[model samples]
Target: MPPSSSTTSARSSRRPRRRRPQGKPQQQPKRSLFDEVGVTAVDPAPFADLGLPARLVRALADNGMVEAFPIQAATIPDALTGRDVLGRGQTGSGKTLAFGLPLLAMQQGSARPLHPRSLVLVPTRELATQVTDSLKPLAKALGLYVREVVGGTSFNRQVDTLRRGVDVLVATPGRLADHVRQGTCVLSEVERTALDEADQMADMGFLPQVRELLDLVPADGQRLLFSATLDGDVDKLVDRYMTDPVVHSLAPPAASVDSMEHHQFLVSATDKQDVLARIAAREGRTIMFVRTKHHADRMAKKLRAAGVPAGALHGGKAQNARTRILDEFRSGATTTLVATNVAARGIHVDDVSLVVHVEPPADPKDYLHRAGRTARAGATGTVVTLVTDDQREAFRTMAAQAGVKAKTTAVRPEDAELARVTGAREPSGVSLVAPKQRETPRGRGANPRSAKRPDEPTRRRRPSERGHDDGRRGQASSGRGARRGNRGGARQA
Candidate 1:
């Protein structure tokens, strides 16, 4: 029983298409702003026309930033348009203002003592403080309030600040978690969330905490995630949380490392200590790198003894102690910091003019990280490594592998070139060795006459006694010879 073509089509049309069981229309999952819109780079001149308040524009102009950096130029418009952005840029590429300016512009008419409208999660306490400092002025100008919640600080104060409510909350994951656990701060009201240094957070193993924090924020809120690299767990984070994020990558990852000046000095074992001292005595703040915690402590002690205000940063230090030492270093109360690999990354301090490797690292990666302590935020810096004669080959290999073309030279305490390279005045009264005479034996072979019994005194014999002993020995030999002669004559007779 075959049906005609029209009858078959009529039957198919009459059959109901499976309808997705439609009670409440199955509320569609909220879409991210990036999913719904496309963003384009905009000039800073049009920010006012784009509806940013006049005061913020004046602040930007006063800061000598006439034009936005590439990251800012790319992401600011998207952020202002309430779109989620995933920004990829080098460390000093002005990503802060990329998100910061838009966050400010969006809060023009917000009332005083504002609730948590925006939240920024950072990896380290130092970074949290730095971000807070960078945003505080702008927040203040906008009649907005910002507060920092980081570890190694007063917990009660953070709770109090949260109770008072803040417009922008800058925090580290651990401390922010503590506040959340203590029921002090609420993330439900966070409309705009930013994860600054997302790669750093993953490196520090804070991704789980970051995930928990993100879960607390509203899913529909605008999100901005900035990182140097988007790989490994960071990529997973992006896939899970960020919706169709507009990725804006300004430069390659290693571009910043390429711009630094790396120099290695070949020094003798005896000269290494003096070379480090001279380098630390340079004009601006210098961070000397050592391989071990004990070495950092010892070097810091020696530098302080030599009249340089110095501090030590290493894993062995307590959190409060580390915080205090870093504070002193940043405030210029201490101009020199002797640290292990702990300060090689995630520490951002301005005006660090020099980085000295008292003991150069074995790996090229370590060398680059140590060198990165200086030359931050597009500022020029010098990195000097004091390599002993035996270590020159290894350091050279590391430099080559790290793509650092360093000027290699022999450095000594008195060399004016050392002073010129290091920007340090020669130490006035440094004595390498003690000025004292050492006694030596006159002859090469051990003196038989000098060998005496333990009971005998080791003093010089008197001149008369020496002469008498010699004469007695000569007479005895003559007497024995004469007796032998007489005996021979008698036998002949």
Candidate 2:
């Protein structure tokens, strides 16, 4: 088909391009980070229907927890199949059993000495204790042993427990690191590990220790990370250690539960304490959050003097003292609990009808956590933040960030608006006697430094007490005091 030069050039230039495929090209469906792998559409169901063993079902039913929460129902099925799970849910969302049940069900054999089959790491010692308490009954029903190793307790006792062999171990990173370094614990045999409150662990600067501990576990072991928020260091942990985790996000990053009500009261500096005392004197269990440990102590003392039964819980207190205070509060011996941020996530008490921010929190996360102390587990509750005129703008910003729409008002201690909002009322004028400490005997085995006089207050703020509640590394001291403060101050799990 020879043609003239001009015609041939035009024909060659216009040669039809290879026909392109019609319609949309074949492509794979994009995957979401939080998709439920190996799981399908579901709803809240009974624990019995979730493939949990009969023993666990019976144990849950005995505790009036026959139904699986949304988080539990979503994560359990995948977790039971030995898949790593990354879960994000709000506080009081029944996350413990979401991971714990699967952790227990997967254990087919008893653990050997110095090695546990499963591990749960928490941020605070109080939380560690609470987790242990919550799981002990269920673990027993499964014929398993759950042991907890936390600071403020006997290390020797923890060692003995490990030597005796434990099926499940709940621990704080700091204390767990100590055990690992001392050869009291070996993680090679651990088949499953869960990091509860992983965000809090990151916030408390325990990620380094957490990473080190995770590295010690077998590379092929299953891991579960549950947190209120999932970002930053938590994401890195998932990427590095987990293999194709099943993600379940039940709540937003800063979830303010539907049952929670927020309010900000504008108070003059002179009347703020009186207003707080009145609100604390209301007819219900209340938790008051202050900025520092000293402030918590002073506020409790002031409330007590105003005839309101109150207890102070802060990182500065000894672990025994902290335990005693929490016990008293839980038993209704003290109606008001004044604390620093240390208790924000550690406490899991029921019927906390009111939470007062005597001092505003450092940020939105702290604010939400402080508010989380109340309105827990679908219970209706109120959160009241007392703010001075100068602090109003800052609080507004924090509230906005925390996804809270708090009703703002200006009122004095005697105003009806104050009463209506916070159930504030006048306190009884009779001063209450402060609880006394038992005196330790001066003997050859006595440790004078560890004992406190009966009537003596926590006198001077030791270097360890300073910045203890901040949940940050100390920039000042580098000796054992600083190390002790870092470990014992915030009561990390």
Best by lDDT: 2
Top candidate, metric TM-score: 2
Scored by CA lDDT, what does every candidate get?
0.71, 0.82
Candidate 2 per-residue C-alpha lDDT over 308-415 given as tens digits, one digit per residue, 9 for 90 to 100 = 999998766766787888999999999999998778885799899999998767589889888889888889999999899899989888888998898989889899
Q: List residue ranges in candidate 2 displaced over 4 A.
A: 1-42, 438-493
Global Cα lDDT for candidate 2: 0.82
> Could you tell me the lDDT of residue 192 within candidate 2?
94
- Each candidate's root-mean-square deviation in Å? 26.9, 12.1
Cα displacement (angstroms), candidate 1, residue 224, comes to 1.6
Error of 1 at 261 (Å): 1.5
